[model samples]
Target chain A: MFAGLSAFPLTPLRNDEVDEVAYAGLIERLVAAGVDSITALGSTGAYPYLTTDERRRVARVALEHAGSVPVVVGVGALRTSQVIGLARDAADAGASGVLLAPMSYQPLTDDDVFGLYEDVAAAVPLPVIVYDNPGTTHFEFSDALYARIAQLPNIASIKIPGVPAEPDAARARVEQIRSAVSDRVTIGISGDASAARGLNAGCDTWYSVIGGTLPEAALAICRAARSGDAAAAMAESDRLQPLWDLFAEHGGSFRVIAAIAELGGLVTPNSLPLPVRGLDRTARDRVARVVRELGLIPPA
Target chain B: MFAGLSAFPLTPLRNDEVDEVAYAGLIERLVAAGVDSITALGSTGAYPYLTTDERRRVARVALEHAGSVPVVVGVGALRTSQVIGLARDAADAGASGVLLAPMSYQPLTDDDVFGLYEDVAAAVPLPVIVYDNPGTTHFEFSDALYARIAQLPNIASIKIPGVPAEPDAARARVEQIRSAVSDRVTIGISGDASAARGLNAGCDTWYSVIGGTLPEAALAICRAARSGDAAAAMAESDRLQPLWDLFAEHGGSFRVIAAIAELGGLVTPNSLPLPVRGLDRTARDRVARVVRELGLIPPA
Candidate 1:
């Protein structure tokens, strides 16, 4: 369950509230796509933008619609107690695991981050996926820290950012992590742009962003790579180069994926929580054009 | 209202909830100390760790006990709509101004940040303080963005991180920001250790951490600087050099200040919100010893 492709579906918001209907539909799409796992409230789900009650509901909503697939809920918060509460909520809501990121405001020390994982892990029985997305949380996880955390109770996976693009370097990075972590802990790759490279390089799973909204395209790359068809995986990834470029051209995957979800009718217009202005019309038009050109939009 | 010594009080928590009584007492202490301004919910206040209702109550408590002193409320959040709501709460709670930090979870674009200030400024009637503490928020504000956001209505100040240590360099840095921002926007210096240098360098305010708990020590620095006694200002700051070193040794001011507050019998012990482990016993002993040596603990 920890290996293979984990599709992170957008928890689309409407009227500044979780649009349950739209969110349920997005989850249903993922279930139908046969994603190995459904990770709700990952960065793509705008977890930090949500309130505790809202996050609980979103977790419950995801589990309800996730069918038989394992569901991992992102329960990262700035406070350890809050994360513990969310982790409990995820467990209560029947999530298969919880994703824990040391989300920071006042930059944390090494002990601070380690203690967060230790406390949360000790508090919850559900499996914990150590989230290492520094781009958003701005908290870098040292290798020693990773090694230390992987020994904690209920730790199931380590979701690292994109690997070094060089294939050998990526492999070295993966091996280094694999050697550090408990053998039971799977290594998952985030950063959708580098999913193929990461998977091809030895990562056991792709904890994806684009896969959240456009599962078919991501599945093409994942299936190819998982089947040992590295060239075919690269080729599949290359086919969607335009969409990847959109992610870079805009900023990160968050807004571009949001635009994709909105333009592809997976979400309502302006679906992103505020402060995050979804791409402007011109940018959205560009995203829509590329998404259409790539045939990412589902046929009605 | 945005200028002079803006003491940032700790909204100390007990048992995972805002310790409102302890909080109100902290505010009263600041009021009695006659701080130039009381900034509730600043980084030292652990605003990001708090819930909206907790934040609202903290703001109201500060205002209620602040006597005639101006109370600047930190209303920063990850979401724009949430900030808008908090800014409204600040206004309704009778805040003198709102301190707006571009708090990030998903790394934000310059446009996204500017739009946040634009939206919040439009939605609130109170003055706004542009809080540029990259140490906590991890969102760097460029001079161009500062110049841009400072132009928005109700922008009363820009609270920047510590300036360059060198007097000439600090002055130049201050001058550069002064040149960029609107004449109405005062340039306040955070980073308590650099308050004297920044204030002597022509920055308008000291948005201080220690000031919230040990107001007299900060007042000495603030008063000497404001009175143009540059040598005296530096000397007074030098007096607390021991405390400042603790801040550096501890990685940041948040935990150190919480330690000070707890040792001085201001807040209950273990006062900070969770995930943020307050200073360990050894560190707290060091903090307590420094507080005693510096004469920061007020007479019983």
Candidate 2:
């Protein structure tokens, strides 16, 4: 079960290979910041873009540096058997659990989606986190479907992405899911700008994007919200507003977050996969101003 | 460039490994049927679901038995660098060319789409086919975007999946693209039942699903259509109606085609990737009747 801020680590690359040194450094910082959990290979981590070999390596490296915190490896794929294979590998690599999304080229029936999770969960002893990211998967789970999936054994958590423009609606959706599922199941929320709203609505964990690179700030927001200190939570959310605005203006948070990590010297400046590009010069400069204003970059 | 009926061979599996013997036989049949081109690792061929090594093997096996016909290997992936790498491998494996779709998790801008094709086309020495399949990729190319992409060096063809229920609309869309691009680029249409309409509307090729397993029937339809024999073309189409109706109902043709290939004893009754399932018992019975009626199944 997860609580507080679950950091989705940004994948650091050097010379076209995953930079283990930089990646470990990022994880160590999150651990030091007392981030509740580390979800490796999340959307920000470019799980779909990596090769199977690369994914295995990333999962292994993440668990190695996670220390006491659980490392949830993203194991989503086009095939159920492939997802099962990844789950086996993740368990063998000592991952805490596997996060699965029903990803497919063809439109999948509700039964097909349920079958994918059931088969994978049955194959591995590890816990499963159902990832509902409609933006990437183009497969949305209705509340009824979510409630149904929550009944499967070993399905430990559900990460629901918050709707960007509607905080109240997003919070209400989380509460609805929360009311439907068992208390044993952990329900978390993703969407950097809306994480506080999700927390206020009683989602137990913040599956965050900016939190992957800016853990201290994310933990502060989580701590404030969890303690019912709305003013403090709003201050942290307001401080992060500039970056969130940039992410909203662009398509999503992946590129802008990577840009901030690079600018802050958290990880080496790296190229994202083709078509999902980083911020333009103007946007990068804006990101730099926000990073400086928030004191994210260490003193030279 | 491609012309006439092009076969997209199904990837057969035996104990989760690519069945080399079954695959080779499938390719040999296409060559014998005088298919103008062979497209390996297509949607029906399950390209995205396969591993990198499996995809390379599929392409090599395809080229090996393609004989006199050109073999176009699908090289699309979620990453640009990955696509370039696959294109390089396709060329190395003696493939005639590569087909690419702007596959991504992020919603790409028009400029991003153009850039992906440009970079991949620049990296390889083979002709590139721009695949515009919105059903799978969810990335639609505006006609202006298609015209721009067609202008890129080494881009030889465009595979446009037909608008199934509307032939006139599909034909008009094809004409718009045809008028926008130079004559050097060949425009082909996919969707088995609509192939006759596409050809009648000036599409140069039938990029087929049934053609992969039952090449003789697909070729007969194409031949009749190309020779201005409307009655013969319609007759062929009407005969194939049961199968085409299945494809339209299923949302995409991959599963139905895979089902037909299995029912006809084409490739040892292969397993398609998860979520892309074959027909149910009732649908399978319908497919069996169609296969028997059309004499697609070879004699024991």
Candidate 3:
């Protein structure tokens, strides 16, 4: 069911609690900006960090606020039982689909990975998206594993990483996955910097991070690629180069984007969890300048 | 307060719930084997996978069953607030110390790492053991970071990885940590294979995994090193060589040891969480053979 651009909204926090008001506003903005989907409890959402109660609350808020936009709730956990529990919670909260990742402290074999997805898919009525993020989960799925997982009932799509730093390799990798999986399972690419190249390689969707805070800018880039307008897509990607570069430099942009949202008066300050220090004054200024240049900040 | 060998007991599961009865029995075995300390919710206990209530129950059970043996509870989490919450819960359950690791889905800077420990230490009156396991947490601590963390008022000790596969390097690494931190803060080394080398390096404590399951064998190695008998330490380590080799081959012995514990009639079979598959029939047979040879199985 994943296609076009899906905005992964950051879970704004207040007083160590999920800021439902702020999250609702964020999702409303994504829907208003014409995003194809809104993903709550994603990596950007700090799904692992939040308690089970908070995840359910976030999903409810995102789904209620998302309205016309489909809301995909991330249901990844260390155990299949836990993931299935979260999947049921997501379905109960009225999420569009559940995104599952094989997250374990211990190494998992391909059979173990297959079994995890199979159990969750069987338990949940909602479509399940296999999130193949080896960088975080440390469990990479081979082509054979992907083919096997694709055969699971209710398996919807696969979200593959597109290393923005290596655009050519990113495109090739996405194309390889596109060829490996069944046609029914859509291939989506993450990593904002690789959006243009990945989409140009015919990836069906962009599971995006920056797209949450700057949906209009992200939508333009995705739309350009969807129409096979490589030049237009590259131009939009180029416009967002500074932000992508910042994300790479900092390891990730979850905190930086939260700071940006705060700076733009989108969310209250100190919305991120503890120890996730936002950009220092100088770096925040640089991000502000880039966001302003792209017309993302200052309330359009 | 950490000294000698601290056994990290695994949390046996039944029907996906923490089998407190089995856990208490495991703690009883560790105490009977004369382990110096018992860590209730350490990595081997699968603390991260358990729910907050389950962790609390496990901590209570370990402390109650541990009797005189000091119980240290692992309280690491992705959020500072959650870590502090766990620490408070640990203290209330009469845990001797709380183990804190800089766990994050996102890579953390040095400042971020220090801030996490400081906040948790200040918030909880209980002593906090800085757990530096980069392989799992993905957040490595430098000597400088260790020095900074040592300054926290309630910070008790640091549990650093001992790369059992490389004994020479492991000794050097433990020595470096000993020199970097103040003598007031104890230094405990984990990884069963590195116990003899780490203890030989004048490390204050051994935070052991296999020690919980096979405490007699682990305690023998620790006692040999503690008494300044290098030859005896290596001999004891050699006695358990097969098990260490299995751990190295399987990425970790968390599941392998779980299987061994079950085979020894310590816990019921299938105690490990799903996706964390135990050794197959053949591998289990091999582990069983090693356990039997070491006299770790066939409980007395």
Predicted model with the maximum lDDT? 1
lDDT of 2 by residue, B66-184 (tens): 88789999998988888888899999999988989888787787888998999998899999888988888989888899899999999899988774446577668777889999789
Question: What C-alpha RMSD separates each model from the true structure?
Answer: 1.9, 2.6, 1.9
Model 3 residue B201 lDDT score: 77
What are the clashing pairs of model 3?
A: none
- Which candidate order results from sorting by lDDT in descending order? 1, 3, 2
The residue-by-residue lDDT of candidate 1 on A229-278, one tens digit each, is 99999998888888888888876888988878877677888888888888
Using Cα atoms, each model's DockQ against the true complex is: 0.71, 0.68, 0.74
Model 1 / residue B73 / CA error / Å: 1.2
Q: B96-206 in candidate 1: lDDT tens per residue? A: 999989998877779899999999999998899999977777779999999999899998999999799999999999999999989999999999999999999999999
Error of 3 at A92 (Å): 1.1
Model 3 lDDT tens row, A156-274:
88887874446577677776776787878998888888888888877889999888888888888999999989889989898778888888877777877887889988888888888
Per-prediction TM-score: 0.95, 0.93, 0.96
Our tally of clashes for model 1 stands at 0
Output the better candidate (1/3) by DockQ: 3
Name the docking class for model 2: medium
**Model 3, A15: alpha-carbon shift in Å?**
1.8
